[model samples]
Target: MKKIFYVFSVFVLFSLVSCVTADNNSKKSADNSSKNAAIENILNRKSVRQYSDKKVEQEKIDTILKCAMAAPSGMNKQPWEILVVTDKEKLEKIAEIAPNASYSKNSQLAIIVCGDKNISERFWEQDCCAVTENILLAVEALELGAVWCMAYPSDERVAGIRSLFNLPENVIPLNIIPIGYPLTQEQPKQKYNADKVHVNNW
Candidate 1:
């Protein structure tokens, strides 16, 4: 009877370990799939200037904004602020100020990335840039269309945006992103250059 009891205990232990190993392998497979999905999304991203008239859902806009905030910042300053503009008049006005954003008129909405001067003024531009890239990446992931329009480093453009948005003196607009459904199918450019990579030392 004692021998039988010991055998039963060993069987149970082996079963538990097998189940644990299977669970761990399943988790690893899931993680790898998720990682590949992200890479695929990044590789497929393209700058879309023409957009269909279809209006972007607020839920998707919220998701894009959430991803923008998730961008990494220097010293965790997180100094970025996002403005979602859906008004037609305002969109037109934006195009007037920055010709690079002329596509904004056709897009259902525009996202204005801003940075606060108080949150490490020296690093605000870099942080805001990261946020803009995040917005673009998220747009691609969501199968939406968008393009990054220049707003900073141009005094005239900055002044025009400031007046249009009534921005405070401390807040600086970084860029304008016009987003909607693509009107035409576009392909991502092959920009990777193997020669640029240097291992260990240049």
Candidate 2:
């Protein structure tokens, strides 16, 4: 009787340990799946400069704008506006402002993302930055090429864009994004550096 009882107790303990181990394995698998999805999306993103001259569809533009608006804003004050430019003549004029941005002239569309300074000065840049990133990612997901060009902080450039678009005085230009179908394939960038990541104490 004593032997039987001891054997039964050991069996119960082994079963409990197995159950715990299985649970941990299951959680790890779920975590890994989530991590893989995020990594895949980030790895696939690339900054495309060369583009085809084909016009971007209006529905596609709307979808990209919708994605941009979904970005989180500071204090929930979404104070950003987007100006879409499709006219070839206007794009040429705008391209002249950035000497290095001759590629803008060939893009199918340009989006001038602006921030309303009247809403919250503390988060104006942050809000606009979030929206710009969203636009870039959305364009990439849609198999389009987009190049981000800085506009804010440059008084002359901001003024030029504002005057060109007849924007309100309170609206501030943040970035100019040129979007279109990619003419050249984007190569993966090898930018990872293990030295950049620090442990908990670092």
Candidate 3:
């Protein structure tokens, strides 16, 4: 009887340990799946210029904006504002202002990432760039298409955007991104360049 009781107790303990291990392994698998999805989003990201006619929903746009605002800023000043345009007429106006972004006319939504010099003068550009990149990645994760069109540093394009939008003197438009369903699928380019890498010394 003593021997049988000892073996039963051991069996119960082993079963409990096995159950705990299985639970931990399941949690780890879930965590790994989430991590892999994020990495895939970054790896497969591609510039998409051509877009289908599907209209983007307000909720998705809001989510993208949330992601953009989540980006880290200098001193956490977060001096960026996004102007989302879904109107056909307004999109056309932006296209005229930025010839390189003529694709905006085809997209259902256009996001203008602007920097407020009043918040952080010197770091505004870098902060805004981080926000723009977040939006791009969020768009990709959502299975949407987007193309970043340069607007700043160009006297002509900057002036045109400012004048058309009637933006304040302190607000400077950095870039325009048009988002929608992709009409063309593109493969991600491998950009791992060991030649440009320098460790400790150039």
Ranking by TM-score: 3, 1, 2
Q: Judged by TM-score relative to the true structure, which candidate is superior, 2 or 3?
A: 3
**Candidate 3 regions off by >4 Å?**
none
TM-score of 3: 0.95
Q: Which lDDT value does model 3 have at 30?
A: 99
Ranking by lDDT: 1, 3, 2
Better of 2 and 3 by lDDT: 3
Relative to the true structure, candidate 1 reaches a TM of 0.89
Q: Which regions of candidate 1 fall more than 4 Å away from where they truly are? A: 1-20
Model 2 TM-score relative to the real fold? 0.79
Residue-level lDDT of model 2, residues 1-202, one tens digit each, is: 9999999999999999999999999999999988986677567778788889788998899999999999999889999988999988888878887544566788989998999989977898999899998898888878898888988888888888888889999999898888999999997688899999999968
CA lDDT of every candidate: 0.94, 0.87, 0.93
Local error of candidate 3 at residue 180 (angstroms):
0.5
